[model samples]
Target chain A: MNREYKTGEIQAGKPVQQVPWLEWLAAGIGLFLVLGIFGVIGWQALNGATVPPVITVTVENVTPVEGGYRVLFRAQNTAGEAAAQVEVEGKVSTDSGEEVSQVVIDYVPGHSDRRGGLFFTRDPSSGTLAVRAIGFADP
Target chain B: MTSERYAIGLARAFGGAIIFGLPLLMTMEMWSLGFSMGRGRLLLLVGFTLAVLVGLSYFSGFEKTFSLKEDAMDAFAAFGVGVITSTLLLVALAVITFDMSWGDIIGRIALQSVPASVGAMLGRKQLGAEQDMQAEEERKQEAGYAGELFLMLAGALFLAFNMAPTEEMILIAFQMTPWHALALGVLSMLLLHVFVYSIGFSGQESRPEGGTFLSTFLRFTLAGYGIALLVSLYVLWSFGRTDGVAVAEIANMLVVLGFPASLGAATARLVV
Candidate 1:
């Protein structure tokens, strides 16, 4: 098959081959990504730990919404496992009474943060606002 | 090769990557799986993807290369296109932001690159000009029994990979009773056989020369279904869906994933 192809090539008088600069560039990019990703994953494998999710929630800010005040918070997972359906509860010690609000975050990956908002009828800033991650399900 | 021709091929690769990768890219579970999945499994997946790409290039690559070296190069080029396309789409979707750690960004892009690269490799057949496709069809006929099985495996893996990362595979498995699992398994095999052998789909493979119905059915459909089940199991394991599941539940999940996998295997010749 190679010989037949070569003879046919001769008969057709094939043009001089153009340099495959684009192909080389693409291959180079691919090579770089393959190596880079391998390196990152390898590094993680060597140094990473497998621990249960340790979630911490902190209040970011409070803003007024339609019917209530929105308390934006960030939930951070510091361990090596991901958590799903993370329930974060916010408690505010208001002068009238204590206002409690809760929000559920869908997922928080290990060593990552997810943002969510909790609604309260009263301004949380008027009192000490405390936000804590109540619990999480294994993802 | 002319630069214009190669350029056009590259363009088609990008198109294919986007078309194929978009579903996984938009999937929320895939994004989280990037960071949450085990590093070892991720590495294994990447390695398998490269091997599949090389095999695919041998059968029908973006370029018609006769040598293994050229095929490898084409595979890498497809991978490169896949990575670039995945990165751009991920960024545009805001799935990966600058604030995320390098590990997260790299993990997300690398995971997504698998489907994108496969799409890029398949793009030539799906999007190439009519004359080029005729040549590709002829080359496909040259692929023998082992090659046919390999294509089935590739197709199975493609569909399985897409579905494995989602939670619904496990959820659906949990919902199914044993009877449902058995019925689904039988239906998968039956449809796989019909699509590949009986139906007159484009690129359908005729029964083997001098082979009877039972022989063809035993050799191709049964083998392809087996490959699909295996591929489905492997993909589910890679996604960590089988880590703590019971053996019975795992079997159910296997049958559930095997449905799309069988379809993919059945349509490998028509699509890939």
Candidate 2:
């Protein structure tokens, strides 16, 4: 009968090397762990507890029209991206002799540039046009 | 038991150093000095040759045991591997950050790393040390490696906060000077070495617990200064004014400075 060579030694074929499958599996798991960690970190970093929307409303053009002022606005996004689900709102006002006239308009799911036109068709002799923006300020 | 194993180990250590160190040094020096790759390559070539000449001076007493030419070649291979590994990592980072398209990033990193790796390998091999001091040298090498890694982290951070143009973080991260980076890396390592010694030499057993704390406190305080020096320079240079510094940005900067110091501490703990 064949016998073993020595202590701390075994036949070339019989020697049980570290389980290849286990090693591979372990390595695979290790890799996944590393990737998962990085992915989670990156995700959390890019969009964490508070991530502001992409596009932001910034006043671009305000001009006086026949009846009311034609207001033009732009959405500035410096985060290297485009954003959706924008809402644009405008408020126009004029002060007459003793009375103040005001008009409010809202734009939902506004187009690109977060831009939508608003005509405050107020009586030219009544008051002035005042425009203010609402929705999405990246602070 | 045999000297051959030790020689191989030395070769690996030095080889690893060259494989890694060349690209690092070159990147930093060139960047700091405002030299591009083409000019930097020329400088690297000249500087590497000079370093080899200087490094070889140590073996003037015994030439038989060590071969400079052979070491240089081996160092080149190791350096190539190091550059490849680093470049790949850089490329992957760029891709993930959406800084570079897969095609552009891969092409650029691969192209730059290949030649840089070759230069690094050669530079490392050329830098030689005596065989008699192998054990001590190996310890030093390990310490140095830890130091370099920490320094790199610091340097990377410094670059990220200061030199990296916010509009082009990805590009600048890759394109920053290798030679300057390496110098800072070496400096960081040196600081770590001193820290290691300070901690190791300071006796704690005979003294009161507060005494040990005091010594550690002193050691760490000095270490803090060293980190602060780099961070301060970065802040002054980048922000133009240290006043009104953003807390988060400061944290990021400190993270960079702390990287190498921690590395040195960890290595010292492990080795000593």
Candidate 3:
């Protein structure tokens, strides 16, 4: 073990000693400890994390008025945060998949928080209404 | 690549993903899950991603005693195995949490994964065969140091964006604890390594003596079963938590945790 590099052994230099089992074991433990700490922290964070407010759309009662029915929708930020721009669309269809009518509304989210309405001439019993919302920051 | 190098590579890829991608996904998941965005959200997301990546890096290094020159094909095969295994584990999570009925979960996955699977298969073919073999040889020659780094970085980024549940996307779903994530990550890597070795040992060149195939199959199956059990436990534990947790969130995390290993394996297999 004490022999210096001889002639033949001089080709590649010196032999590398294998890591001891104790060193490996210690390293393993240290690694786990670090991981466990992060794990706990992340767990807590996920459990108590918050999210952004969403633009909400609600449809009011649908009653027959003349040929089409009247539908009312309200949009608001229930969280009271200022959303920039809001756009809502509605599609009315008959039970046979016939498109009765559609409408779109656009407004500033916080500044123009208001309710709007639309009228569609279609059979009430066989009609379905679908609404979608898209929001953005207004320039 | 050596096992040590592979592990290091996974660490870097995964770590990079968390740092860069986790926040965006988390934000999306949280918002989707109906949580209000606040100051702590960013910090929490960043912290969690870093933590998971660090854990993965450590685990990869821990497995360095094993050989790393195992071909990439073995890793891809292991990933295929993992997808099946993760599916079952996910089913168990759904059952335990009651977030989704088994029927519903299975049905949705069946519908959704078809496109994804088709895409992966086609993409795999286009990536080349002999090129992969040459690359594998080159990686081996380089001691897999660079390959590991590339993989770890790529994996981490992919997960941060595509895998971690976004705030807005967190719906009625399950959540995973870091313990579960760490365990599952390590367990998946181990199973993949075993599969790699089993494949090598089964080869005519690698094992000229050619022992019984049943013994190899049995050993691999048993190890796979053991890994499945551990993964199931992690999934079960994750689904048990529901405080603003969406079923998609846990599901997404599982993908993030498992994706890198699978990707690294698949990439190697495809290239080799």
Candidate 4:
């Protein structure tokens, strides 16, 4: 610490009591950041014991489109990898068998959701509707 | 040699990391890549990034250096600062956690370390320029072509660093038609050339008049675009965007990313 030379010997000999605002600020930020990081890690560890949820496809809404009925479905992924080209299938039980409708979803990132719609020329309100995740690939 | 100067440099470096490297730290794809990217690929990317940092240090570093050795040393030093900065921030954000494999933590930090390191380097130049009063005489002389090229790299790195980590690069490529991609490429080149011409850097005076048009467009514009493409490719690859993608799709993504990189390249001289 350099002291002013012009000052008297007593003053000059005194330790320079200068405040390093920037260094202190930096240290403060760094300490705050380190503490914040530990806090977050602790929070996450408490919250993340649960495994990534498997994607569950559920029919969200059924509405009438121009030509046919459009069934909106939501695909939720629990895993870390993206589910690409997700194919969601809708099967309506008929007296005869099962009438199926499938829609291709572009992608759904892990721990996220994507919406897609399936079109059916024939009204399926007359039967039981079931939707399932048929397949997916990495994007 | 004052501690104040060191503190200021460090403060500026932190600012640089936030300014230049923060977006990627928050990017979802980047976080995903930290886990998905193979170790070999990650290592290669780190090696290449270090090389570019050393090269940039020679041209426009946090502090000017007279020798390749100094530049190399500065590169590693900046890298150390960058890694520590990035790791701390990422952990603060909970981007790295104990649940993730050790590989995941290292990969994420190393990948983010590139732009953070560059930002650290730029912090010195951007914040400490006033201290360089003695170098004014040496700086006045036009930087050679290699210097210009490095400047372009810096600019491209600055701009591309923000966009490369996003999912938008692939999303945009997927959305574009062939015509759209072509138009983007043309526009990128045109803008790159026009931006440089508008700036009229002193470095331009070196071009002789006879074949000036051809030389300028070919030598600078096209070359800048090339560097941008390389940068885009590197960024995309480092982020794991290119893995398992079709060749055409990769090319499209490259062009999409190259647009900003070329703009960065074109405007390098003004920023530096």
Candidate No. with top lDDT: 1
Q: Write the per-residue lDDT of candidate 2 for residues B144-248, one digit (tens) a residue.
A: 433333333333332232332122322322344555445555565555445544555431112223556556445443454455445443433332223355754
For each candidate, what's the DockQ? 0.50, 0.02, 0.04, 0.04
lDDT of each: 0.86, 0.36, 0.36, 0.69
Write one digit per residue (lDDT tens) for candidate 4, span B1-272.
23576566776776776677777788867766654454456656666777777776665565545446545655665676677889999999998866554434665677787778788777776666565533422442435576678778878977887788777778999999999999999999999987887556643333445657888899888999999999899878866688788999999998999999998898766555
Query: Comparing to the true complex, what docking class would candidate 4 get?
Result: incorrect
Off by over 4 Å in 2: A1-139, B1-75, B84-134, B138-252, B259-261, B265-272
Kindly list the per-residue Cα lDDT of model 1 for residues B1-272, writing each as its tens digit.
Answer: 66678889889999999999999999998898888788889999999999999989877788766556667788888999999999999999999888776667888998999999999999887898743566566566666788899999999999888888887998999999999999999999999999998889988998889999899999999999999999999899888889988999999999999999999999988877
Docking class of 1: medium
- In order, the TM-score of chain B in each prediction is 0.97, 0.31, 0.28, 0.87
Instruction: Kindly list the per-residue Cα lDDT of model 3 for residues A7-113, writing each as its tens digit.
Output: 23332433223333443333354344334433533443454322232566778767788766787777654432234345666676766665534444433222123
- Report the alpha-carbon TM-score of model 1 versus the true structure: 0.90
Tens-place lDDT per residue, model 3, B149-205, is: 333333333332333333222321235555655665566655544444445532111
Q: In model 1, which regions exceed 4 Å deviation?
A: A1-19, A62-70, A94-96, A122-127, B131-138
lDDT of 2 by residue, A44-69 (tens): 23432123334555556767788755
For every model in order, the TM-score on chain A comes to 0.77, 0.35, 0.46, 0.59
* Residue-pair clash count for candidate 4: 0
**Candidate 1 structure quality by residue, lDDT tens digits, A1-139:** 2423423553354322433777777777888878888998888767653678899887888899999899888898887677888999999898899988888888887777888888998888788889999999876
State the weakest 10-residue window (summed lDDT) of model 2 chain B.
B29-38
TM-score of each: 0.90, 0.26, 0.28, 0.64
Interface RMSD of 4: 10.4
Ranking by lDDT: 1, 4, 3, 2
